[model samples]
Structures are given as C-alpha cells and as structure tokens.
Target: MLETTMPALASLEAFGNVTDLLVRRAADAPDHVAFDVPADDPASWRPVTTAAFLGDVRALAKGMMGAGLVAGDRVAIMAPTRYEWAVADLATWFAGGVVVPVYDSSSASQVDAIVHDAGVRLAIAGSRAHADLLTRALVGTDAIGTWAMRGVDGIRSLDDLTGRGTHVTDAELETRRTLAGHHDPATIVYTSGTTGEPKGAVLTHSNFLGQVLNIAAAYREVVTPTGNTIIFLPLAHVLARGLQLICIASGMRIAHLSEPSRVVPALSVLRPTFLVVVPRVLQKIQAAAADKAARMRLGPVWERAVSTAVARGRLAEKQDAGRRSRAPRGLRVRGAVFDALFYSRLRAIMGGRVDYILSGGATLDGALSLFFRGIGVPVIEGYGLTETTAPLTGNLPGRIVSGTVGLPLPGSTVRISPEGEVLARGVGVFAGYRDPRHDAEAFVDGFFRTGDLGRIDDGGRLILEGRMKDVIVTSNGKTVVPARWEGAVEASPLVQHAVMVGEGKPYLSALLILDPAESAAWAASHGSTFATGSPGEVRAIDEPRLRAHLQPTVDAANALVARSEQVRRFTLVLADLDDHELVTPTLKIKRREVLHRAADTIDTLYRGAAS
Candidate 1:
C-alpha cells in the first residue's frame, strides 16, 4: 500500500457550526442578495436578502415549536430545488431537528424507504404533486404528517405554518438551539444506492462547517461574495447541498432551477460565474458545440479550430521564461483567429461569464476538459461521497490539472490500501453509517473505505481508476477496469453512454447509446441521410448511417486499451435508459442492475448474433 500526506493549508479555519454561519451572514450582510427564485410573472425574478431569509426561517422554526417539534426530531423535505426548500432546511436546523431530504422525482416506494428508515415525523412538500407521492407513502402509517410549500384544498401551506407560530417566542427557539451543538446530528443524507438499499449517512453540523470553510478558503478567489451560481442538481445530492451551504457562508449569490432541461436557458439569463455540475453536463456542452458546428457546415474547419486553441492553451500554461517566444508563429495566428470565431462565440451560450465548473459524481474526460479550457472555461473536477460530507479532494481555481481530482481537502487524509482501495479519515468523514452492520465492512483502522480504486501522484492529485466492485475478470484470467475504457469511448464525439461488460466471459463486450441530434449531424456531414426524429428522443440504432459513424468511435476507444480489455462485441440499445432503473439519480450506472436488465442481450451477444 502507498501512503501520502499533506498538511492543511495555513488559512484553513473552522466556522463554528452551520447555523452560526447563517447567523453571521445575516447580521454582517443583511441587504446582500441571498437567493433569487423564479417569479410567477415569468419575466422577472424574486430576490431574497439574507435578513429576509433569516426572518422566514425563524418564523418557520417557531411554527415547528407550535407544532411540538423538539430537539433530535426528524423532518423530511420532498421537493425540487427552490427558495422554500432552503427555508424548510434551515427551519429544521433552527428548531433543533435533523433534516432528511428526499429527491423530488423519487417514486412512492423510494420516498417510503427514506421516511421509514429515518423515522421522519413531519414532511414539507414542494407542490401538490409531490404531496401526493408522500401521502401515498404515508397511507396506513399514523407516524407522519405533511405540509405543502404551496397550498391545495384542505392542506396547510408553509405560509400558514409561519402564521400559526405567531404566538411562539424568540426565546423558545433560542432555548432549542442551545440543546444542539457541534457534534449533534444536523442531517441524515442517504446514499444514492446504485446497488442495494440506500444507507443513511448521519452528518454533523461540524462536518459541514469544516468542509465549507476549508473549501471556500482554498478557492477563495472563485467562491467569494462576487460569485453567483445557479443550482440545477437535486438538493438531495450531497454535492449540491454542500455547495449551497458553501455559497451561503461565503456570501455568494445563488439561484435555483428544479428542472434539468431548463438549465441552458437559465444559464443564458443568470450569467453565473461558477457552477456545481456532473460530467454529463460537460458532455452535453461538448456535443452541443459539435452540433452547432455541423449545422453551420464548418466540419473540418471546426475540428481544426478546436485543435489549434488547445495547443495555444497548453503553450500558455508553460512556466519557462521563453515559453511565449518559443510558441510557433502559425499557432499564435490560428489561436487568435479561432478565439474570435469559435471560442468567443461558444461563450455566449453560457452567458459568457462562466469562470469555473466544479464537477463531481463521476470521472471527467480529460479531452473534454482540455476542449473547454481551449474555449476559456476551466472545469475543476473533485472527488467525494455522501459519507465524506460531499468533498474529500477538489481541483483549485488557478492550479487545475485535467483528469485529476486535485489535492485532498485541508483536514482530510487519503491513503491507498494493498488491494488498491481508496480510504479516507478526517473531521468531514461521518462517524459511522446509520446501520451498524455496515460499519465493520466500511472502516479499516478508523479510515472510511471509499470502495474506489485510485492512485496518488507526485503532485498529490487523486486519479481514480474505477470502482472495485465494477472491475471485470474474463474467462482468460485477464482483469479489465471498465471506467478507463468508458472515459476514452465518451471522448469520441459520437457516443453518449458506454458500458463495458465481460465477467466470466471469453472477451469484453460493450453497450452504446447515441444522441439523436449528434447522430443527425454526423449523418449530414458524411453525405448520408437519416430519418429525423423528435428532438431529444432516441432513434433506431440499427440504421446503416448510425452504424457507419459508430464503428469509428468503437475503434478509437479500443486503441486506448490492451487487446484483452478491448470490447470484442457491442450492442446498441436504441432506447433511453431509464434514470431510476439503469442508473442512479446522479447518472452513475448501476452496473449489476444494468447487467441484469439486459441479460437476454448479453446472451445474444455471446451467441454471435448480429445487433
């Protein structure tokens, strides 16, 4: 096993607790814009200041008191990203209760699993639609009560709850706050179980406070008061929720969008300076750029422009004193030309102000990272899990290195085991899982086993290979790490999702999904015709035009791996993979689940049948 350690940055200092940061921000910058929620008028936005936000939270906390909520009580929120979701979260903390967040898109059974596991007694729903799911889950169970953020017939609204707390006094809330402390449980965030049942991860106020302060300090320039971000990921996700608190503590302005489909339109209007995203968003951006290039008939010219820009970007990063003088004259000329025609034009789509993108939840493609850097947008990839309070390592603002989750966080320590498993130990790491049975298998000598295979480089950057459980061994006794191959396959502009399959088999195989828009563009550029389908829907993959483009992508991916690890056969699913069944909400494929769902296809592939 290899081990490395880096001391915490000198500037790293602890904020007392989650609520303390909220109180300080409200008192220090009362008029600062805290959040901007969508207005019913559709053309305008509703801004909430820090002081006004605190008032709403305090009022809701008092309402909890009026309804007999006490210290250690569990409250669940079933909602999408919105202003009231923030209110409910803070109010639960202020009322000295533990908050349980449920994904807004979760089915009735999934909602029931969380509520029952956490013993949540009170739930706040975003709309009647969300409340309906909750009501169905709570049927025949008298332990839970529900409130909606928006009113419906015979239902209490959040506004009504605040009004009901009119008789509750400030002293009562203060008394409740004193009942909790740094080590007290603040939230019970569940794992996005891509495999088995979700396990509750109990994170304390201190865990959040430490991580937010250290991350803000490390990336002080990008996470300052001047930073503005629009959150589109589900708040139930640890990364999204942690970023929300980091923005609050750093006095940054934030906006919320519930629907993923609305992100592009919102980006054009919000002009956000930074973003918290997954690898899929970056992939989409790259695909969109390619589609636009194809539509404008700049096929070869577009590819050359991107290549020239990347060369210039890398040359500019060299620290040699004569680096600028050494740059070829032709490259400088092409860089300037492309900067005006291609790079600058692309920036307009993202409001032309995005400085950095904080990506997590999956490994990012190095080629995609450089492509964005070529266009003047830098993506800072990070690594973490819900058990670690969202982030264990992250790439910093000016020191980003493509394809590596930069140095470990200030207070965290990472180590690799003999079996190549990544382990972590830190104040941010949870004390233990909610289920005692998981603790033994999850911890080794006090370090929380991450279950991810990785190695630390000389620069202290963490390079993840793949998940330990997802590694496949073939009948020939060769081991294959699929994530390595999948990342390379995605770098090809033609494929959308790639899954490597071959366990206890003679050779590796793959499953590929193609984006319809991109396929159409490829077909057009290649002098072929394809039946245009509805926008964003999957098209039949067996068509000759698609097969012609996909073969090159598969070959390009094979060039990156050994012959034994290469995919010998592949099948195109021709349909969109359902989010809940084949993958988790964060877009991580449930390997076992996907393999099970496609058992027949696997059999056909081995039988040498044509796809």
Candidate 2:
C-alpha cells in the first residue's frame, strides 16, 4: 500500500466553529472589502465591507432565529453564486442551523429530493424563478417557507427577513451562535450524482476548518487581502463552496458572477490574481486559443511550438533534466516568438495578471496543462470527492506536477488499496454520508473509499486512473479505461467530449461532442456550410467533408493509446454534452447517463461504418 500524509498546520487549532473566521475578520478588518457584487452594468461592481457583511449575516441570523428554526434544523439556500448566497449561508450557521445548499438552476424534482432528504423547512431563493422552483419543490410538504433575495410577488424578501430581526437583541443572536460547536453539521452539500443517486455528505465545522486552514497555510503567499478572485462555478458544489470560505477566511477580495457564460469576459474586466475552476473552463480556453491560431493560418507552426514545449516539459520533469536538456535553441526561439504572437494574446484575454489557476472537480489533460504552462499560465490540477470537503489533494504553486494531483493536503492521509482504489482518512474527510446505512459501503476499515482507481507515484504525487465502475471491457475481454482515451480526445481542439462506449460489446465506439465554434470555423475554412442551431445544441456534422476535417484530430488521439483502446467507430453528438442532465455540476460527464440517453446513437455507431 502507498500512503502519504502532511501534518496539520497551526491555523487549524485557532478556530472554534468555521463561522469564527467571519467574526474575527470583521473584528480585525472591518473596513476591508469582503466581496464585490457586479452591478447591472457588466463593467462595474459594488463592494461589501467586512463590517457590512457581518451585519447582514447577523440580521439574517436573527431573522432565521425568529422564524422558529432551532439548533440542528436544516435551512436550504437555493441560489446562484452571489453576495446574498454567502449572507444566507453564514446566517444559517449563526442561527444554529445546518445549511443545505440547492442549485438555483436545479429542476424542481432535484430540489425536492434534496429538501425532503435533508428535512429542510426554510429555503432562501436567489430570484423569482428560483423561488418558484422552491415553491414547486415544497408542494404538498410540511409548509416550508420561501424567502427570495430579490423581491418577488407573494414571496418574503431578504430585506423583509432582515427587517423582522430588529426586535431580536445582539445577545440573543450570540447565544444562538454559541450553541453551535466544532462538530455540528455546517452544511449538507449534495453530490452532483454523476454515478448514482446524489448522496449528502455530513460535513462538520471541523471538516471545513481543516480544508480552509490547510489550503491557507499551503498557499499563504497567494492567499492575501489584496488578491482578487471571481466565483463563477456553482456555489452549491463543495469545491466552490469550500473555496468561497477559504477566500473569506483569508480576507481576499472576491467578486461573484451569477452567469457562468460570462466568466471569461468578467475575468478580462476583473483581472483576478487567481482563479479556481473546473476543467471545462480551461478546455474552452484552450479550444478558443487553438481555433484563433488555426483561423490565422498558423496551425502548423502552433502545433510545432506545442510539440517542442511538451517535449521540454517532459524532459524537465526528469531528475537531472532542466536547462541542460531543454528543447533545441532554434525550437525554443521559435516557441518564444510564437508565445509573443499567439500565447500572449490568449493570456491577455484572461486579463494577463493571473498568478496561477487552480483547477479541480475533473482531470485536466496533461498536454493541455503543459501547453498552458508553456504559455506562462500554470493550470494546476487537484483531486477530491464531495465527501472529502472540497480538496484532499492538489498541486500547490511550487510543487506542481502536470498530470498528477500533487500531494495530499496538510493533515490528510491517502492510501492505495490492493485493488488500486484510493482511500483517504483525515480531518478533511467527512465523518460519513448522511444516511448511516451507507457508512459500511463507503468506508473500508477507517479510510473513506474514494471509489476511484489511482496510484501514488514514487514522488508522492497521486495519479488518478478513473472511476472503478467506469472501466470499459470489450467482448474480447480487453480492459479499457475511457478516461485515458477521453482525456486525449478532449486534448484536441475539435472535440468537446469523447465518451467511449462498448462495455460487453465487440470493440470500443466513441460518442463525440465536437466543439461547435471550433468545428464550425474549421468547416467554414474548408469550404463547407456550417449552419447554426439552438443554443447549446451541437449542429449536425454528418457530411463526409466534415468528418474528413475531424479525422486528423481523431488520428492524433488514437496515436496516444493501443489499437484496441483506440476509438473504432464514432458518432458526432448534435448537442453540448456539458448540459446539466449529461454532466455533473462540476462538469464531469455522466457516462452512464449519456450512454442510456443516447442508446440509439450508440447502436447507430456500431451498425454504421467506422469514422
């Protein structure tokens, strides 16, 4: 068994409940801006000071207390990533209630499952649409009350809730806050359910404190008051929620972007020093950069530059390989020229000031990571499940490894089982799932079974091999890991998602979701008509000419793997695979869901000629 652990840092010992950070930050730096909310105009943002933020939390807590929620009661926050979401979240903790987060865009049935399972009675909605969703979710239920952040007809507004708190004294609120302990459930964050039913992890104050303090200590240089960060991912996800807490505890200046589609534009304007995101964002960035290069008729030169950089990267990773064995001087010169011409423009699009981007929730392709690093932006990959309270292992600034998930977080322990499953045990890990019955299946001995196959490298970095259940076995009995091929396929600018299917079938076939913009641009350049389709819909590309254009990308990906594992027959999907139903909130495609929904397409791929 391979195991590694980083001892807990001193910061973890200082907190009582996780909420203490807010109280302390407010006391120490009351005038410091805690968050920046975007105004109606996209170009401007409004700041919220620590003092004002705490006051809002206090008022909301009093309102929640006055509404009859007692200690241990669950209160749901159904909202997008916004200032009000943060206020409601902290207020729930201060009110001595467990925060049960619900995604603002979630369907009513999804919301209903979470609320009913968590036994939630009070939900704070971000908008009228969200209030309506919550209303539908709570129908025929225990008369759950709904409060909207924005004013809505017949729904109580956040202002109204805060107004009711005027009668409640400060001492009473303090008394309620004191009732919460380090072991109390801080939040019931539901998993995105990529594999199966979404399980609620019972994370405690200590669970979050462990992550926040360890991450702070690990990245102390970058976690500063002046650092700017934008919250664009769903706050409902553990990674984003944990990141929000980390930013608040570190006193970083934050901006919340409610729309995910506006992230790149907002980044250019906000010019955040650091960014935390899922791999999909990076994929999009890479695709756009490559598309632009191709449009400029610099594809061959760009490819050569990327190849040289990747070679240099691989050589540099070796023990005695640095400048001594770097790429040839001529190649390096050409790369530097291309970096100025192409890569710099890409960096400028992201505001040119990003120190380093921290990505988790999904694996970033190794080549893509190296390409970004070559272009002067380091995209660090981290790994963790929702049950681990955000991140249990990640690539920090100095110790980054391109393909690996760096090292275990300070205070966490990771071990590889005989079967290659990664098991974790530490303060960062949740005690268990919300359902006691799942404990036996989730934990092996004392370690939390990650259900992911991975190995610990000699350097102590963890390399994920993909989910155990996701392994595809052919009728010939050759075992294949789809993520291995999928990661390579996604590395191509033409592909958005490359899902391999053929479990118990003859050979592996792929369901390809081409990057619409890039594919369209390629088609247009090749003298073919690329028609537009509905929003997020992938337009049909069944023509032989389009397939011919995509063949080189497919051949490049196939070169990375063995013949059996290479995609045999392929079918192009006409819609974005990143759709909510097909992918998790964190952006990992739900392979089973996609296969089930696209059974007809899979059958067609198998029956049709190989692309």
Best by lDDT: 2
Per-residue alpha-carbon lDDT of model 1 for 1-611, expressed as tens digits? 26655555533234445787788899899999989888887546888899998998999999987887778989989888888888899899988999999988776778888888888878889888888777766667654478899867767788877777888889988788657777889899888787677889999987887788778778898887887999888888878888888888788899998876777778788889998888877777766777678789987888898787667556534522234445688987887888787888778778789888888888998767777876888888899999999999987766777778877888889999988899998868998877788788889998999999999887788899999988999888899888888887766656667778888888888877655466556667778665544432333345665666577878888898889889988876543445565557776667677677667777767885332
Question: Could you tally the backbone clashes for each prediction?
Answer: 0, 2
lDDT per model vs. reference: 0.80, 0.81
Residues 1-611, model 2: lDDT tens digits: 39988787746567788889899889999999989888888778888899999999999999988877788888888888888888998999998899998876677778888988999878899888888887777777774488999878888898887777778899999988878777888998888887888888899998998898888888886778889888887888888888889889889988888776788788788888888877767877766766667879978877777776666556544422233564668867877887787778878888888878888877888877777777777777888888999798987775667889988989899999998899999878999889888788998879999989999988788999988888988888999887787887776667777888898888788877777677776778878765655654434457687677667777877888999888877877756654677666666677777777778778776675333
The root-mean-square deviation over C-alpha atoms between each candidate and the true structure, in angstroms, is 3.4, 3.0
Per-residue error (Å), model 2, residue 285: 1.8
595: Cα error in model 1, Å: 0.8
TM-score of 1: 0.93
As a whole number from 0 to 100, the lDDT of residue 383 in candidate 1 is: 93
Off by over 4 Å in 2: 308-332, 516-541, 576-579, 608-611
Question: Local error of candidate 1 at 152, Å?
Answer: 3.2
